[model samples]
Target: MEENNKIFDDEEEELYEHFSLDVDPGQTPMRLDKLLAIHLKKSSRNKIQNAIDSQSVRVNGQVVKSSYKPKPGDRIVVALPKPPREPTEILPENIPLNIVYEDEAVLIVNKDAQMVVHPGFANWDGTLVNALVYHFGQLPTSKNGAIRPGLVHRIDKGTSGLLVIAKTEYAMQHLARQFADHSTERTYYALIWGEPEQDKGTINAKLGRSQKDRRVTEVYEDGGYGREAITHYEVLKRMRYVSLVKCNLETGRTHQIRAHMKYIGHPLFGDATYGGDRILRGNMFSKYKQFVENCFQILPRQALHAKSLGFEHPEKKEWMQFDSELPEDMQTLLEKWEAYVQHV
Candidate 1:
């Protein structure tokens, strides 16, 4: 029972949730999972089923089965792994933002790889949240009132890219719906060791935290355990040992691209979490080793960048898209690889 209420680690906190809802007075009786599917657009049916199987779904504070018929006015609570942390008072910081586009409703900013998106355990300050609070006072918070405010989506600290910020409550709801429905377009570029067999392919797998290591997210191939994740990859450029590829995400699971790439035998270069730090393939000479080390120094973080994002304007109802260039580190890494692959 305690396992069902376990608190998520820092990373999982960004993507997971602890939600509570009161069944509408006019709500029709329905299977727990089926009812939840309507409310949880971001949650896959399999995930809700697994939550029910693990006794993580509760009705009026009592654990229930997936097939249980939810009655009107029943208070339902679901833990996607666990509950959120006690709220922390967010303090503003004068950190600068590279605002790409901004209006009354929304803003887009290109984030640096080193900055955590929001406050969490071990990361209270120097976050994008602090910057947001300083720049734009009093933004909308999540329904649960977790630390996140104004953020409709986030990227990993080690993965730099574009993120959309909601400036108004209505904008928040609008963008949130887009992400939950998988209607938002997000493409990431990554440098990975070894090229995938097919230039264009898709990775369909389930992702959940590894049992042996709670800090790491792992791919679960078999059903009944993890959330569905899909990443469509197209190789953009190939050197001898490494390749640059773009991944279009269908679902935004924690570490979806990193874990999926590792599962498919092509972990991103310099991704210390997924065994990409070590030389996984190609020339084994001592000179090659030194060259690899040099490349690692050029890009200390995972060689992944959020390259583009597309979404509909919440108020205007017009489609909008934004793109970003590779950061200096990733750009230099590729230039070095280009020389080395050509035997320079």
Candidate 2:
């Protein structure tokens, strides 16, 4: 077995593995999928082929098809999404889903906060995948058939907002290409502690797992490590100590927005993992502390929401956009901030 180095991106909040391999100098040309199947022990040819069809396989830094024959000295890179949970008989559960749109090709859902997108670890049931399986019955799976039927992209468990699921194999391949190319449009709304110095700015940083804590993401200043992440933000409102901001992601790394905001010293309010749970801003007064605590109580999770998503239809080739209202908890928290600002 070839030695494989697996780097996990906790920010993406999913198990995606990136692999890089150099063809032997004397190796003969072979089909890319076959080469990957041989090199990737856990992956099957079907999975590698699906990744190629979705443009996730690259030769010499350019996306290639499975049919391409990799010559000796060629460098191959592939990215595969690993299902969070082990493959089991996923029985459909009658869970409530706020489905915004549905058709034979796709389904758009507005996931609620605190709900796991898929079953993983201790969360074995009552997930969005379980709900999808129950509602849609048998859905399309990736090549390996890991059981995340119909899911194309995912939002963090603490985030509430829109996601697109593909109903057919062709649709899945098409949607996957869009995400890999970074063509899909995604926007998020976040209530963060402390206002940014600028009204609108872009953060270009490299993100990798923190050496101190693997669960959290850290920004690299030298850009020598990790994946390149870009986030554009504009302040929507400022309530003295806290601010509401809109974030646009150029690259969908795990926890991109959360980590980037924290890197710039404006961690999202209530983001326990990134040190936003403590009072970062505001006065030392007991009343002020209590007010912040009350806000935290009202919004228990990270104050981030996937507010909008847009993409092209796989079959129709038409542009489609989805928008979701903030959940009651986030909205209520905003109201409290507004009220506090008015009173003060």
Candidate 3:
């Protein structure tokens, strides 16, 4: 027999879950972590071991190790703590969603611009997670019992594009493993400020958090501190000053495309975070400046979209892929640039 319950704090920062299990009379002795992993479908053996090391797991009111094995009739109690600052209570909102595809195991959503994918500090409400909770109700948790729900990957709040979410623990685990193994395919469309000298190229660099601004990521030339990131890009259309490009990602690091583009002096147009809002490549004429500003107004955020995503289905074991069209803002911005290039 097993009993489980969860408690949340007022600020939604910390979560505490208690699990009590009575050993079966016919059960053979097994490692505590392995047993806990079997009992908690959302938790992994490593997470169970961490709980045991944190003195959060006890057998018969005594702290135990990962190697501890339980006998029949033993009373086991486990206390699990979630990551700090993560919301404990995520309230569902009646926000509209552009659901592209959905099945019992997975869901593909065409996430709109200006939507936060998950709940975090300073962004607890009006997030995609809130809307998901409202529509779907009580999603499966992560390995550490955190309420990511069905999220397998995330796009930036300003970026619009396709996202695949897992609806079950098996799907979550399987998709997570695929992403970790770099087997999933992701492609993006970006409008960069300057035209690249080469039509197609690859930017291989290590990425890490910038010391100057902790909020953004930067490319590390020395490969000293950051993880490896690779982005392959090809010029789709050149408008003399700004060019539209397609980028394929080999590794999904934070700000990989934005940072890599900036490193090559071709940041995505209107990307205020990486010095792309200014007139980086156009002429000094006031008319050109006004045109650039107009384009900026049309497409305010970074002109990047997660255009496509491909992965293997967890349940069916079949390869699945999805694509999304560019949002209206991006389309209008591109049209303006094309007209300007043709007239000038």
User: Which residue pairs overlap in candidate 1's backbone?
Assistant: none
Put down candidate 2 lDDT per residue, 1-344, tens digits, no spaces. Answer: 22345764633435364787778777767788887887778976555665787666777778887788988778776655564557478878999999999988999999999899887778888899999898888788877657789887888889999999999999999998999899999999999999889999999998976655557888989764568999999999999989999999989998999999999999999999998999998787998899999988998899999999999999999999999899999999999999998988
lDDT of 3 by residue, 1-344 (tens): 65656563432344354677889888878898888888888976545665687677888878888898999889887755563578778888999999999999999999988999998867888988899889999677787756788887899988999999889889989999999999999999999988899999999998977756657999878654678999999999999999999999999998889999999999999889999988999688999888888888888899999999999999999999899999999999999999999999
Cα-lDDT of candidate 3: 0.87
Give the per-residue Cα lDDT of candidate 1 at 188: 99
User: Which candidate, 1 or 2, would have the higher lDDT against the true structure?
Assistant: 1
Clashing pairs in 3: none
Q: Which ten residues in a row have the lowest lDDT in candidate 3?
A: 8-17
- Number of the candidate with higher TM-score, 1 or 3: 1
- Clashing residue pairs in candidate 2 (N, C-alpha, C atoms within 3 angstroms): 11-254, 11-255, 12-254
Residue 203, model 1: Cα distance from true site in angstroms? 0.6
For model 3, the superposed segments whose C-alpha errors exceed 4 Å read 1-84
Candidate 1 whole-model C-alpha lDDT, 0 to 1? 0.87
Question: What local lDDT score does residue 313 receive in model 1, on the 0 to 100 scale?
Answer: 99
lDDT string, candidate 1, 115-165, tens digits: 999987678789999999999999998896686889889999999999999
Residue 28 deviation, candidate 3, in Å? Answer: 48
Q: How far is candidate 2 from the true structure (C-alpha RMSD, Å)?
A: 9.9
